[model samples]
Target: AAAGWPLSELFDRQFASWLDLDPALDATNRVPSILNGGLGKISPVYWGACLGAAAAIDLYGLRKKRSDPDYFPGKLGFDPLGLYPSTTTGKRRMELAEIKNGRLAMIAITGFAFQEFVQQYAVVDQTPLLFKPVSDVVETYGSIGGYGM
Candidate 1:
């Protein structure tokens, strides 16, 4: 049991590392805000674009995995948990798919957040002029031009 403990720890670390590198697992914070906010100051069109991009990323991962299951680590045989006596079976493949799907879900969630962010913060036209450059006025009108005029 003692010897098996170290192996288990190592496997856990590897699994975590692999998951981190998986593109499907990557989740940006931007998606959630848009979904929650639902187009305030920002444009709805931009939010839709962001959501579309996220969907594309997710689809890319699925397509890549389908094309080559071995594209990811632990595909052939490298059981992290040692729960299975052998990793060469349909069950192991299903387990891998489950893990991948979990990551995909996270990606999707974050993508939604990103869409929200776009809607909340993205600038539309320059009509309102939230914060124009004071320097422009200073330069055009001159710092002391008011007194002279």
Candidate 2:
């Protein structure tokens, strides 16, 4: 249980660190390192290839599902990237697609890390927290004056 706790704590800390990193830095630095180093600890090249393949599959699926009317303005169909006008309806569809796909991808990737963390720290009893959850810890020492002591 003690061993598991530390592993859980480490995972929680690392995850919080990743969340706090700047988006640009995350892309250029943290992401590759975590994906390659953390996940890579299990399997490096395999995970990297999996990430690339997943993205490609997502792009291909999106391209294949595009409607004819979505690509063609009146009668002429645009072949280059098949980009259409960004109307309210179009924007809404795009947003929905992105949200749906993004969520699935996030879940999939996070699930992998979570499994690894649990496996690595199977003996731990308590999980780590980014911040203290108890109110007393956050409150001032002198501020416990209200109500009944």
Candidate 3:
């Protein structure tokens, strides 16, 4: 599939896609601190909270499924060891997971955005030099900056 493809054209298109990779690239450039800023603020407490929320949603879904009438006989609506299998045809054991976890994903995403926003303007950016080149960090700010390459 590499036949007759002009290097320049391919390069241009690829470059465009690269720009899309970090729409916030421009923003990161504008605000070096925030973009490069360390998110160490994502403390253990914050991690515990995210993990707790995700776990709570998982547990709630497990309980709901237990009473869902779809659970296998003699199995508390779980696959094994009181744990729900993420995938199964028997009554869609994880349907609740999709619903509950989907909501958690949304809430968590929103929370992350809010945290970044506040950190960008109000908090001091403490980005580590070693981490500045990380793809995720670059993407986070690049998308915000509308990085068009």
Give lDDT per model, in order: 0.46, 0.44, 0.45
Looking at model 2, how many pairs of residues clash? 5
Residue-by-residue lDDT tens digits, candidate 2, 1-149: 22332334336446656787322222212222243343333345667898999887666656655744353212233337766445989856765776787787776556544643444322122221222344543363347633112
TM-score, candidate number 1: 0.26
What is the TM-score of candidate 3? 0.29
Ranked by lDDT, top first:
1, 3, 2
Pick by lDDT: 1 or 3, better one: 1
What's every prediction's RMSD, in angstroms?
19.6, 14.8, 16.4
Give the winner by lDDT: 1
Off by over 4 Å in 3: 1-22, 29-89, 121-149
**Best-fitting candidate, scored by TM-score:** 3
Q: Lowest summed lDDT over 10 consecutive residues: which window, candidate 1?
A: 23-32
Please tell me which model should have the higher lDDT, number 1 or number 2. Answer: 1
TM-score per candidate, chains pooled: 0.26, 0.26, 0.29
